[model samples]
Structures are given as structure tokens and as C-alpha cells.
Target: MKRPKPTRRKRQNLCADKGYDYPDVRQLLRDWGYTAHIKSRGEEQSERKQIPGYRARRWVVERTHSWLNRFRRLLIRWEKKVEN
Candidate 1:
């Protein structure tokens, strides 16, 4: 899919969390020429670990949720269509 796009436009890298850590997922990404940035989830992984930014970004969303909860409609998901 991405191979054809490189001829027309620039290809983009995909990001994922720990859920997509399986060997098959990583292999598919490699075969497609993508740089995997997924965090590993196993005891046998390297001792030196890279800190994930998702935890810090989650704090920002928590703060936003705290602020938004003040509105009853927004908290209840009153909108019929999500696109709205």
C-alpha cells in the first residue's frame, strides 16, 4: 500500500503502544519499511528501557477531562453522530 504512495507523495511512519509488540506486527512493519516505535511488553526485554511519552500526554488529557466534566451535555455524550 505504501510502496505505491512513495512515487506520488511522502510516506508517513505509524506509532503504536505496547499492544502491537508481537513479532508478526514488527515484521510486517519492517517489510513495509516502517520504523517501529512500539514499546516492548515482556520480562526478557533489555534492561535499558526507553521512557514512553504516553504517560505524560495522558496527564494532559486527564486535566482536560476534569475541566470538561463541568458541562453536563459533554460528559453524557448527548450528540447522536460522533462526527458532529
Candidate 2:
């Protein structure tokens, strides 16, 4: 099967952690037309202190995972039937 073409946007953002904060990774992301939002190591804490209401992109995914974890059935996939 042929690969589907990705939809292009005027400003596409890529949220990543400090591990991806490298010149090569940044350049690759730029080449692929993504605006990288990867924070450098130890940079987040300082920014949090300076900015009153700053929140990183990854936190949203973490928060959602935390919320889902509260539901044992959903997290563990207790239901075998798809209809359930």
C-alpha cells in the first residue's frame, strides 16, 4: 500500500523533552518543517520559577495518563470483549 501524505500546516509544533535537545535533532525537525519545543536539561525548573503560569507540552500528556491510571479497568484492559 502507498503511504498516505501527511497534512501540511503553516506552523507545525513538535513537543519533546531535554533528551532531544541537540543540534542535529533540531536541524532534522526543522528540515521536516516542525517548530521544535524541546527544552534543554535543567531549563524547565528555572523557567517555571521565572514564569508565573508556564506549563510544558509534555505535562498535558502526563496529566492525562495520570487521570486514566485512576481507572483500573481502562488502564489494565480488564474487558476482553470489544463491545464492552
Candidate 3:
């Protein structure tokens, strides 16, 4: 039996909350070659809040969801055939 190879992650950044800012967690992220974006305790809110322009990225996600919702089959799969 041939085992399937694991798929590599394309994005290298690891975004997390302050809870993951521990030293061990940071070391783990470094070992995996991921750039950690974890927030530290008492750290002020990022520039995303101060600068409104930075929030434009969120629209991309919202727009994609809206576009997908336009497809009735994607919203609710009514096709009986698995390949349909």
C-alpha cells in the first residue's frame, strides 16, 4: 500500500492570541519555521485599529463568503450524485 505524502502549508505565519506567547510556544513556532504573530500580555492593540486602511484585508474574506453564498448548491448541497 502506498502512503500519501503530507501536504505542506503554504502560509508560514502563525497568528495567535496572547495566551500562546509563552517561551515554549515561541520556541515551537521557531522550530517549525513559522513566524509567530502572537500578542504579548499588556501589549497595545495593533495598528490595524489605529489605521483604518489596514482593515481592508477583512473585506476580502467577507467578499469571498458572499460570492460563495450566491451558489445555491454550495450553500445547500441538493445533488444526489457524489461527483455532482
Candidate 4:
């Protein structure tokens, strides 16, 4: 099936978590002009101790996730469709 096109332009400077740390992911992000802010999961905690900005940014992302979860439909997975 054909995927829907994005409403916005292609992205740059993607701030993904460690889950997107693989070479393929990083390469793709780079190809799109995105400075992948993804660190290896094993290095994440250690890196935070060295870089205050990483800690701050990570927390903001986490807080945003928590906020998104506050929506009842998102938290409960109310939709029967896979998109939900």
C-alpha cells in the first residue's frame, strides 16, 4: 500500500533516542541533513554525566512523551486501527 505524503518538508536535525543509533539509521539521518542526536543506549547514562545539554534535552523529550500519554485515547489504545 502507498503511504501518505508528509504535509511538511523533509526533516533535518532529528532528535531520536538511542533506539535509532544503528549505522543504517544514522546514515539515513545524515543523508537527510539530520544531525542525529542518538547515542548508544549503553553510553547514554555515561554521556549525560559529561554533557549537561544531553540530559536536559533527553528530559524534555521524556516529559513530552509523558504529556502525550496523558491523553486517554493514547494511553488506553482506544482505536481498533493499527495506526493508533
Candidate 5:
């Protein structure tokens, strides 16, 4: 299935974790005009480390994902209706 179109304002930034560092995901974010702040696995190394202002927000996203995973229906896409 194709992704839904975003109707929000422009220049919005998306903060995600290292798991989302794939090329296809980055390309899709670019196609939607979103500035991706996803951390790369390699960046965890001492030589590549750099402090980012949005680094504090990464934990929040990770926590939300973990919480969502607690529900079997949502985690496995068992729910069909959006309002369900």
C-alpha cells in the first residue's frame, strides 16, 4: 500500500532512532519535504560522535514505540479500522 499524504505545514522535522537509518526511509522523508534527524548506527562510535540539539527528543520517540509494541493488535496490525 502507498503512504498517505501529509497535509501539514512545510519544513517540519522528524526525529527518529538509528533503526530508521535506511536509505529508502530517508528518501521517503525527503520526498515529503521533512528534514530527517535519524541517527545512524555508525555515528555511535567515538570518532563520529557529535552532540545534536534534538538528541534529547530521541528517547521520547523510542519510548512511544516501545509502548505501542505492548499491544499485540497494534504491534501486528490486527486492527483494521482507524477508530477501533
Candidate 6:
């Protein structure tokens, strides 16, 4: 699959969990013109205690996966034919 090209008009942002909190990943994101919003391990927990109504970036992605999992067909590969 082809990757989408970054637009110069507006800046792009990449939200990821602590697992991707590496120097290489940060450099790659910078090269790709994305504003990385990756937090270090335990950073989110500390912020959550101090800030009210603070939400982690990964929460949205996890919620989306939870919603998608409700659909049995999508959770499992039931279609053998690509046209289906």
C-alpha cells in the first residue's frame, strides 16, 4: 500500500504510546514532517494524577479498536474472496 504524502499547508502529528519512545522513532517522525506526541513510560500516569480530565493519546485508538471488535466479521477473517 502507498503511504499518504504529507501536506505543507498544515502540520501533521503522530500520537503513539511509550513503546515507541525511542530516539530512532523520534528522528524518523521528524524526517517525515510529523509532530511526535509520544510520552515516556509512567509519564501518563503522573499527568493523570495531576491534571483533571487529561486523556492519553492511545485511549482514542484503543476505544476505536474496542468498537471495531464488536463486529464479529471484522474481528475474524470470514471472507475468503477479496470481492466479498
C-alpha lDDT of all candidate models, in order = 0.67, 0.80, 0.73, 0.70, 0.75, 0.83
> What's the CA RMSD for each of the models?
8.9, 8.7, 10.0, 11.9, 12.6, 9.2
Ranking by TM-score: 6, 2, 1, 5, 3, 4
Off by over 4 Å in 5: 1-9, 47-84
Q: Least accurate stretch of 10 residues (summed lDDT) in model 5?
A: 46-55
Best by TM-score: 6
Ranking by lDDT: 6, 2, 5, 3, 4, 1
| Clash count (model 6, backbone only) | 0
TM-score of each: 0.43, 0.48, 0.41, 0.40, 0.42, 0.51
User: Distance from true position, residue 30, model 5, in Å?
Assistant: 0.6
Which residue pairs clash in candidate 2?
Answer: none
Please list the residue runs of candidate 6 whose C-alpha ends up more than 4 Å from where it truly belongs after superposition.
Answer: 1-4, 7-9, 52-84
Residues 1-84, candidate 2: write the lDDT tens digits: 984433446647889998898999999888787789998888879879999777778988999998877796664675766767
Q: Give the per-residue lDDT digits (tens) of candidate 4, residues 1-84.
A: 984433236544567877777999888767755667876777866866887665355788888888877885665766766776
Regions of model 4 farther than 4 Å from truth: 1-11, 47-84
lDDT of 5 by residue, 23-78 (tens): 99999998887889987776665433454443446788999888877885565675
Per-residue C-alpha lDDT of model 6 across residues 42-71, encoded as one tens digit per residue:
987887899887766898898998888878
**Native RMSD of candidate 6 (Å):** 9.2
Model 6 is weakest, by summed lDDT over 10 consecutive residues, at 72-81
Query: Could you tally the backbone clashes for each prediction?
Result: 0, 0, 0, 1, 0, 0
User: Which residues of candidate 1, in runs, are more than 4 Å off?
Assistant: 1-13, 42-57, 73-84
lDDT of 5: 0.75
Best by lDDT: 6
lDDT tens digits, residue span 21-65, model 1: 889998887776676788777632443345443233578898888
Alpha-carbon error at 22 in model 2, in Å?
Answer: 0.6
